[model samples]
Target: MADFDLEALSLSELKKMQKDVAKAISTYQDRQKAEARAKLESLARDLGYSLAELVGTATKITRAPAAAKYRHPENAAVTWSGRGRKPQWFVDALAAGNTASDLAIG
Candidate 1:
């Protein structure tokens, strides 16, 4: 591994370096996964079984539909599923003295 003097790099140079490192890591990970898949396929062939037969084929991920849980009173378009972080509109409304239940969808 080449030694890098991080302290000598300017802020912009450091950001560029960070992006480059991230991209390199992503590329390396993808290559490693492909190689692993190839090796597994080869082994499966030798064992008289297709890769899909050995490891079941990929299944479609099914998630229950997210229903609107909260909506902006002023704008119907602004709504939240209430699953993750509260949206900015919801926070603002709450700060403006509106309770969470007030925004609940029927």
Candidate 2:
């Protein structure tokens, strides 16, 4: 976050800030997910599982629990799902005209 420049923005200036921030967050998350896939692939190769097998397993998505059964250390607002698209709630909030930061972990 130190790399982020978020100083001196009026409420009216927040629109552009919001757009930049959303893109930045999505890019960062995508990087994390790709890294996770690569690590898993390397481990699979070491254990005799083919990259194809590892990738197939990774591509499958699992639904989150009904309540708060997950946690994210970085930002409580950001839940942990092994890295993917924004969760449904976040998408809904965005669609309803709320910024990502408007949501919280707890």
Candidate 3:
């Protein structure tokens, strides 16, 4: 049973509610850590790599083709065309050899 009315909670009651939410978040984080640790242990056994070896291997992996983040040169920075579809020059660049990926900032 609740100690206080739900509708009539004062500032102190709100503080207590916040503390309860924080405790719940802490418990959830602890549970997530436990689950991640268990998954890593199983994955390590299957891969025949220690946790440290797995991390070291992961760090060596390069970006994939689909995930490639390309950027144009700074000299290529445009004089901003006010809104709407890309300007004719931009379309021409695409039609020429430049890829949308090559122009992507991220």
lDDT of 2 by residue, 1-106 (tens): 3664446767667887788889999999999999998998889889999888755644667776545433443357646342556677666666888765555434
Please list the residue runs of candidate 1 whose C-alpha ends up more than 4 Å from where it truly belongs after superposition: 61-106
Give the alpha carbon lDDT tens digit for every residue of 1-106 in model 3. 5486767888899899989989999999999999998899789989897777767644566643343233333445553232456666656667888876666655
Prediction 1 global C-alpha lDDT: 0.95
Poorest stretch of ten by lDDT in candidate 3: 64-73
- Global lDDT for candidate 2? 0.67
Q: What TM value does model 2 have?
A: 0.41
Q: What would the TM-scores of all predictions be?
A: 0.54, 0.41, 0.43
Clashes of each: 0, 2, 0
> Between prediction 1 and prediction 2, which has the larger lDDT?
1
Error of 3 at 104 (Å): 55
Taking the tens digit of each residue's C-alpha lDDT, what string does model 1 give over 11-101? 9999999999999999999999999999999999999999999889999999997998999989998889998888899999999999999
Candidate 3 matches the true fold with a TM-score of 0.43
